[model samples]
Target: MSEPSGDASGNDLRRSSALVGAGILLSRVAGLVRESATAAFLGTGIGAEALRAALRIPNLMQNLLGEGVLSASFIPAYSKLLAEGRREDAGRLAGAIAGLLLLVTSVLVVVGVVFAGPITRVITPGWPEGSARFELTVTLVRILTPGVGLLVLSAWCLGVLNSHRRFFLSYVAPVAWNAAIIVLLVSVGLSTSEQFTVAQAFAWGAVLGSALQFGVQLPGVLRLTRGLRLSTSLAVPGVRAVVSRFGQVVAGRGGVQLAAYVDVVVASLLAGGALAALGYAQVLYLLPISLFGMAIAAAELPTLSTLDHEDRRRVVERIDTGLGRVAFFVVPSTVAFVLVGDLVVATVYQRGNFSEDASVQVGAILAVYGLGLLASTSSRLLQSSLYGVGDTRTPAIYAVLRVVVSLLVGIAVMFPLDAVQATSQGISVVGDVAWQVAPEALRAADAPNALRLGGAGLAFGAAVGAWFEWLLLRTRVRIVFGPTRLGGPHARRIVLAALAAAVAALAARALVETIDLHATIEGLLALGLVGSVYVLVARAVGVPEARELTGRLERLVDRRAK
Candidate 1:
């Protein structure tokens, strides 16, 4: 096998990380804007709920089968072949995978379109009785389902580019996605409601967004590869291996999708914008994890794959060393959401059709989700490690474990705490949420009540599931590195750093509250001051790692300034 020269290997990792990071960053911003716009146009209404629910089908499928899993399984194999000097064969593998994806996704999209109503019935049966919400959802799914194909193609392109250590263009595709959606939202707003329903416009935007995701990367892909020819031959050598790996990737990824499906089922029982609340909450929770945790995961993958057996030890060590930094970045962000969740919801979404009540409700969900952010972020990195090692099944196993625990926890917790009823005790503004996502709607509508009966079941499920995931990670780490060598001063330093960050975050929260800066300009100013104070405290509290990060950041700024 031909090994990548030192310079070439280093350059490859850097370029891919930068590109994927850039694309993810852009996509995250655009996604926030899309969520904001959707909230504005539809609010927490039946329309919003239906739209969010419908959108999930395509998105869930995409996430489950497209990005992480597809890339995880495909990239390693592709990279291995290339490293062995099998360029033409690698290219052929890419084309074969792409052709297979095209065929499979094409079939799925058609099925989705034809059976949209039945799918909706299965997924969100209680979508507001006697309302056209159900019908509209069906319509929207049909319009958006084709996106599955485009996105699958985009994923293939991204994986191919990542294999080549080219990442920038792929990352920017999301910028295009958001821009397209923003345009659609603006256009719809400018026109009369009679002209086009927001649901229809958003669906069209989805199709356009997926196209943009594919289109933005075309030039890059074309430059990297000669051309793609659809291979009809099933006897393609690498095709079976890639497809089988993809299946493992899909199973591993399926847990997250299943978790999402559970949310939908729960929200369906809850009725009246429950889906929107959960959707909004999930996105808000995902932001920091995406920003920070993903930065490390994205950077680590290609490097991990190329590491020699001995150097692979460093791969695990790098992950451990980076976890502190990841926590330092992510913990505070999660806290910020927890502390100012209501203000955030109010600020970004509480206008137009989204009322103060809706903001409060979503805020509550966001707060609970905050507790699990660290677990979620760490899980992603852990899975990335598994991918790097070409062991898709381990992560798949962990995912299944997580889902089972989540479901069990959800069931166990819902029966005892009935936390929904409990949330109403003090927060009148969000009291409706307890009522909204309740089992009553299901019983009243004669729908299955498993979701509501399973209430707090989902939340507890997440908590328990996250624990199992964390355990899975520890076991893996132990196997990689002996148990005797694990958990000492290094772990202590990280905990202390997290403690410092937590304390700083709490102080920031208090200052923001004291200045009454939560609702207006004063709040923004206070938030800035609090963030500054946290940095200072983090530095003083022996958070040298965090301090180093800030130092590196300032050096970059200084260089830019010069």
Candidate 2:
């Protein structure tokens, strides 16, 4: 358990990050396929809205106690015990935490199933009682609660494997989860004409998927801790430490989940398809954040947890490198979302029953969400670093502040925007190519105002809160590490590269549009052109990370050629 040499540590970090990123990439692609299928079947209607709400409600359990909380509290404690060579104690602590998680999740699952109606009311007040949407949501929530319990256990497995530095299996395991849903969607196609029945099938598929997700990771966890056994005893040496930290981490994660739930509630009150539109946009927004931010942070946490208290310099170095790498990828991704989000949304979700109107709505929401991509991703690494140093309380406090800010801003913006109906004249004033594609159904005089701009307001509020959180986190890191080197020259170079790449991408998109090509084909060409230009521009700017990435790609290409 001794620390690797400094040179070795850097390489290990990069290699581990690459592995995790590969797994996330596959899992995310599968996830996108699952979402695409959902959109094709449900088409952002009332059925889609109900299913989205139901999924979010039970997900509260996993979000509150799942990977984020465990990474912050349980992983660090257990990892430290392992570093100290207390294998027996580590095993016991792991078992105890697992048992406790199951017990609590089981109780919550039962309560969630029984009180599905009341729970739905609290989370989504816009849906009327006795309505099909409300009833379907309640039913789906009941069926999905057990799956939440299973996912909680899967998260426990993730904590174990991560602490042991077995990163690939745990990260790759979600493919099973996504695959289950994909298979179910494919099998039931055309067999069920009703959206309600299709949604029911999806709900059950999700439950089966959760079980497979957990089952796939169990063998790895067992292999890592051969002697571990389930126990409810909290009397182990480090068990109390984990328990105490768990509450703060849970509160911190809960604050984040609360902000999301607030958005859901606000979106629900807006229009029938508002929540569904937000859900679709969110999947696209989260892609880069997961691929870059979570992959790097998750890889670094266990290593950081093992650092000596006197080695503040090492911790500072890791933070800088991780943040820079994250920004390198995410900045361009943000640019893509802002510039070509309509194309991206249209390509992904505009087929079948998902109309051009739905695409426009989701595209706008994505553009707004793009504004917060850097802040949101940066906050993830900052929080992970703080958790590494055993200071969970500060992040928890700032998280609560972020929730308050998001809620206030959401209300202030959403209501006023919703009041202004988009008349024919008003629609002309909002001149954009993306808007030209909107269907007649969305542009009609009787269309709901909420469908026009409410989702964008929600997105804008979330962005404001995300930047606030990032500011607070960055300030704290400076105080601890003495004026972080993350923002001066390096940031300027990244922004310049991203701007150049975005311009090239825009040109590529224009060329593609001029020709008679499908939306999907146009989007792919633009993305490829932009991505290639980004790497070339970044390399030309003397960015070391960019050069390193290029070198890796070259080596990969050579291997393939061989």
Candidate 3:
């Protein structure tokens, strides 16, 4: 009967999660730099929209076949084998999944390349069939297809590495991917000013970078999985279990990815910069989820998979503890994004072609996304727990439900928002239903990647869908597990501390309101002040995760001093 907040595995979970977070932090920082460079060179122009759509289009293959699906389908059964000291079986499981993924992804890559045009049409129907923007998006999609396949294999490598408790390289390996893009973007920026040419060059760079990312992980996977023998046989004993889970996880991941795809499609229909603005906001929005939420869930999964499902007490304690850890970090993140997100966006992106106006648009989208940060992060852990307990189908069902809700809401809001034109005179209506009757009227507003607020509707819809999924998950876990509900046991204190922190942040901002300060410096002062206030208040409120973090910092300092 271990308490929800104080489990024996807490230390190991924290250490492992820290490792995962550290790796993700490095990769995400590099990703931000890559994004910043893209914004600087392309701005929120037609080139930027095409590039963002192109990058995401072939990523359909990766999302269907990548880390989220693999983490659920492959990791649990594989981890169980290793925990039982069955390295040979573990290797066999790894090899089969890798071989299967290779076969599936290779075929998809070829199909993606061959049918890139049709796929592009479906993905970005907003672009006319033979327009310059449309054709360019088609071409970039073809270029990035094979590269995305390579990323799928890289995810397989991650499954092997994480199963072996080598969290850093698998999570950090994307640094190579990001770095390669940055290097090419810089080189091309120096040589040329052509937007289409820049887009093409970066697409090729992405392909090369994908190869590097996969290459870096293969050696480690090989070393750890010595008994591995590659095959496509479905007859392997545990292979059936993996495949069954894989199907359900694919459905789950597919639904989630589809929500994103639909958002892109709708954004394409909005004014020009909506796609790029959405892209910018998402890059920031996903940071905390990847760093804290994904990290903690990843660390817990292998351990959770090895636990006895019949012993519900142990499982509940693990999940509740992890959720609390996630909430303590994410609550304040939500506040930051909502209350002072413009500062965050300006600090990262308000340079070169990424104008102050663009930053404001992106920040507005981010604030809506922030309102759902807690739901999204909490759902990540709940989904992991469901996967660990072999209840993959439940999450899949909810994921689809979430998407349905999101699409209904998103489409309803998007068209109306699109009809509302932004003018020099400060916003005017382009007829209440002009998007339905006047295609020309909507196109007049688009302006090839110009700023628009329509994307925020998609963000708002997504936030609503996220809460629905989280609530369903929270209840389902309670029913499935014996006596406990899935949630952040420490959410109350964490949220209160965050509210207090937000108040202090507001005061700091007011104090600096009239001062002439650069976006970066102003952001640092506000974020730092808010963060410090959160930590101190959380400590006073006796939030365990905060106390643990502070205690760890103090311990490290003492050790360094000695």
TM-score of each predicted structure versus truth:
0.86, 0.93, 0.94
lDDT scores for all predictions? Answer: 0.66, 0.81, 0.84
Residue 272 in model 2: shift from native, Å? 2.7
lDDT measured at residue 16 in model 2 versus the true structure, 0 to 100: 83
Q: Candidate 1 or 2, higher TM-score?
A: 2
- Summed over model 1, clashes come to 8
- Model 3 Cα lDDT, one tens digit per residue, 1-562: 2232344488889889999999999999999999888888888887888898998888988998899999998999988888778899888888888889999998998999999999888988777788888888999998899999999999999998998899999999999999998999889977888888888878988999999999999999999995798899998759999999999988988998988888877777776678888888999999999999999999988887877778787788888888888888887778889987877888888887778777777877898899889889889888888888888999999999999998888777776665554432344565564444225434432365445678878888889999999999988888877433333677678867988999977976786678979877877888888898999999999998889889989999999999
Worst 10 residues of 2 by lDDT: 428-437
Model 1 stretches astray by more than 4 angstroms = 1-19, 128-130, 193-196, 226-228, 232-234, 310-312, 414-457, 481-494, 507-530, 540-548, 556-562
Best by TM-score: 3
Clashes of 3: 4
Q: Write the per-residue lDDT of candidate 2 for residues 122-226, one digit (tens) a residue.
A: 887766677787889999999999998999999999999999988888888889988988788767856876878888888888899999999999988888884
Instruction: Name the better of 1 and 3 by TM-score.
Output: 3
Instruction: State, as a TM-score between 0 and 1, how close model 1 is to the true structure.
Output: 0.86
